[model samples]
Target: MATISTLSDLYISELKDLWSANDQMARALKKITPQATNAKLSQLLEEAQTGIADHTQLLKALIANQGEEVSKEHCKGMEGLVSEALKHVLEQPPQNGPVLDALIIAQYQRMTHYGITGFGTVAAFANALQMEDDGRQLKDAVDDLYDADELMSELAEAAVNREAAEE
Candidate 1:
């Protein structure tokens, strides 16, 4: 992590941390997305990977715009989240079909929530630092993650959960 002596240092450090988080989440999604059986869930997972990539690019641009190298600090918070996701979905495979789909949603949402929190934090930091454009961009990213989470909830309530219960 950067020294973080000032708010500027902290803001840049967070950007780097989030960059690493996105990379970790994206990789985990790549492996986990295939495990999703529901067509919509699969599609959402694919789109999420793309979204993560986009967010990563935004983080890089933010870092560069801040006059820093587009480097990243390893985000241990996301590392733990990704590890839990893998543990539930891959390391100890859930039963396939709706049950696995349900598990996938649970794991995916957990990671999504983490991203939301992290991005939201940095967005506030950006705004406090008077980096309005960067703050707005980060907040927009948070909104996207929230939308994804809502869709996952809708999927669970509309079908996945019921299907899992029936199984």
Candidate 2:
């Protein structure tokens, strides 16, 4: 008789899916950089691309560490975010320079919040699973995710808010 083990398998799958989604986001953001009218927005998009790449690499490494084959399930959460961002970009044209920058900043914050929450959830799940090494790695990654969100928030407060308020 053969016994099947399910522990950590679902999480492993989810990690890969998230990795793929982030990789895709990086690629998309690379394309989106040219569309950014504001310099800060453009730089943030570039930073996001780099962050996404790092996340993808870390996720792949984590999956490998677990002795599981890397495979990505479809990530509907990211897809929905992408769709909403695109819709906003298309539908509501900014009235002025400051308004445009604020809109961009708002989109960036929304995306960052999503990533932070998602990563935090995964890290907690890893801890509960008793995968100490995986949990630690994921915890570190989640920290990075939070840092990224804070950076965007800082950029928004320093520049975007000022610009938006001026006009």
Candidate 3:
């Protein structure tokens, strides 16, 4: 990693971090989706995988535009979160259906929140750099992530939590 001597350096670093985070999230979603007992939760996880792929491409293009090599530094934050989620899934007893789905939703929300913050931070950096188009693009991605998070919340409140309570 390079020293952050300027805002541009910080911006590039953030872009790289997001790239790594998205890659980690893609793998996590694959593992999580199959464990979800709720059909809607499973579908949402699949859709999020596609969104992560698209966002990764966008991050690469943004980095390349800045004359930086398209490479990612490993994001330890995301790595830890993913590892914790996997631990939860693996360590828990296998008989609980709704309870497991509820846990998955919680874990999914944590990952989405990380993405929301990362994209929002990059968008702010873009705005500071006077790159309006880049800022708008990052903001759009942030909005999509927020929408997914909201949908997950609704799913949890409407069905998953209730089912889990019965378990």
Candidate 4:
């Protein structure tokens, strides 16, 4: 961790945190994807893994562009969310089918919301620093996260929840 003497430092710190969070999510999604019985949900999870990887790379580039060492501060917020998600999975003895799919969707949205906020915040910071290009890139990432979250909600309301009720 470096000393935060300016907004740029704070911005870099937030980026590092988000980078770590995405990395953690990528790993967690791999574990959870196999537990999902819904084909759409499994596919989305796989896609999210790729998105997270791309976002992580963006963060690394942003940090390196600032002439700072590319590193990650442990993201405790994501750690807790991941643990809670795993707990939900473990609590359900038969981790398959619609019920599990519903839980996975819920957890997935929760984490996506976190990413949206983190990316949006960093984008704001970029704008404050007069870095328009960086702000635009970060905002694009945030928009992508929002799209994924909205899709999950649609899946839950239109399909997964209904299937869970039938189960």
RMSD to native, candidate 1:
0.8
lDDT of 1 by residue, 1-167 (tens): 55779999999999999999999999999999999999999999999999999999999999999899889999999999899899989888766599999999998999999999999999999999998999999999999999999999999999999999988
- Each model's lDDT: 0.94, 0.71, 0.93, 0.90
Per-residue lDDT over 1-167 for candidate 3, one digit per residue giving the tens place of the 0 to 100 score: 99999999999999999999999989988988888889999999999999999999999999999999999989999999999888887566346889998899999999999999999999999999999999999999999999999999999999999999987
**Per-residue lDDT of 1-167 in model 2, one digit per residue for the tens?**
11336646667767866875685566556644666677877887787788777887878888887777766667777777766666665456576766766666676667667777766777777888887787787778778877777776787788777878888
- For model 2 the TM-score comes to 0.83
lDDT of 4 by residue, 1-167 (tens): 88999999999999999998998888888888888888889988888888899899999999999898899999999999988988787555354478889999999988999999999999999999999999999999998899889888888899999999987
* Error of model 1, residue 140, in angstroms: 0.6
lDDT sort, best first: 1, 3, 4, 2
User: What is the TM-score of each predicted model, taking all chains together?
Assistant: 0.97, 0.83, 0.97, 0.96
Candidate 2 C-alpha error for residue 121, in Å? 1.8
Q: 1 or 2, which is superior by TM-score?
A: 1
